[model samples]
Target: SGDLRIEMRDLAVFGEESERAARAVFAAGKQDEYWDYHNALFEGGEHRPKSQLDDDSLVSLGEDLGLDPMQFKQDMNSTEAHEQFDTVASEGQSIGVSSTPAFIIGGKPLLGAQPTQQFTDAVDEALARAES
Candidate 1:
């Protein structure tokens, strides 16, 4: 909806592997391929096991997404990418978030997975508040 804008923040509460993956995503954003990489990583959902998201897998995903392999790899391992991931993770922590799939609408925390209706209701409420 034009009235709503969604911003995704990565919180690596899952562990080091998740942190690395998050860093890779942030790095991908620099090349204007964040969504492509993100979608590719989670395309099959549960069918795509966590074990397959290692450093090598991340680079391969970048390559598959048409990103430059060498540049993508360098960016993924860069200090800037690590810093960006840490910054976002810290922002989530400051808001009492400690897990993935968390949503915040109009500064209200909607922790964990929710039904479609819950998101719709939150969006409606937020839009109403914004309009007022």
Candidate 2:
């Protein structure tokens, strides 16, 4: 349940930064404040990390979402939290992932953060291959 889901490698940067934030949320998942933090960063239809993804913002999101402030902070910087994300990155690298949002369909490498139609087309092709 406290697992980090990553689809990229070269996490030297990710492991030390972005993943820390995500791990904090995942480890604190039991507090049920995940969605609130998630919504705060994403529901607005834009990720304004400059204003919404900082310590103050994270604290605000946790409180607004009804999570314990102390616990949220602890998990936010916990070594375990960072480690969880590191594992995800390592796994991704081992599996040939070099970027974010990469998908492996029918053993094919599909890179890039594209539109829904692009993904749909890939899925359709993968399904067709499986059927054949």
User: For candidate 1, lDDT tens digit of each residue in 27-110?
Assistant: 788899988888887786642457776888888889888899899989989999888887998889888788767899888889
Model number with the top lDDT: 1
The true-versus-predicted C-alpha distance at residue 106 of model 1, in Å, is 0.8
TM-score of each: 0.86, 0.65
The true-versus-predicted C-alpha distance at residue 21 of model 1, in Å, is: 0.6
Q: Highest TM-score, which number?
A: 1
lDDT tens digits, residues 1-132, model 2?
322233323233333336545665664574765656655645667645554556767766777777888888877777766677778777767778776557776667677688889877877787788778
- Where does model 2 exceed 4 Å of error? 1-16, 50-56, 129-132
Worst 10 residues of 2 by lDDT: 2-11
Which regions of candidate 1 deviate over 4 angstroms? Answer: 47-50
Give Cα distance to truth, residue 75, candidate 2, Å. 2.4
Each candidate's root-mean-square deviation in Å?
2.0, 5.6
- Whole-model Cα lDDT per candidate? 0.84, 0.63
Query: How many steric overlaps are in each model, in order?
Result: 0, 0
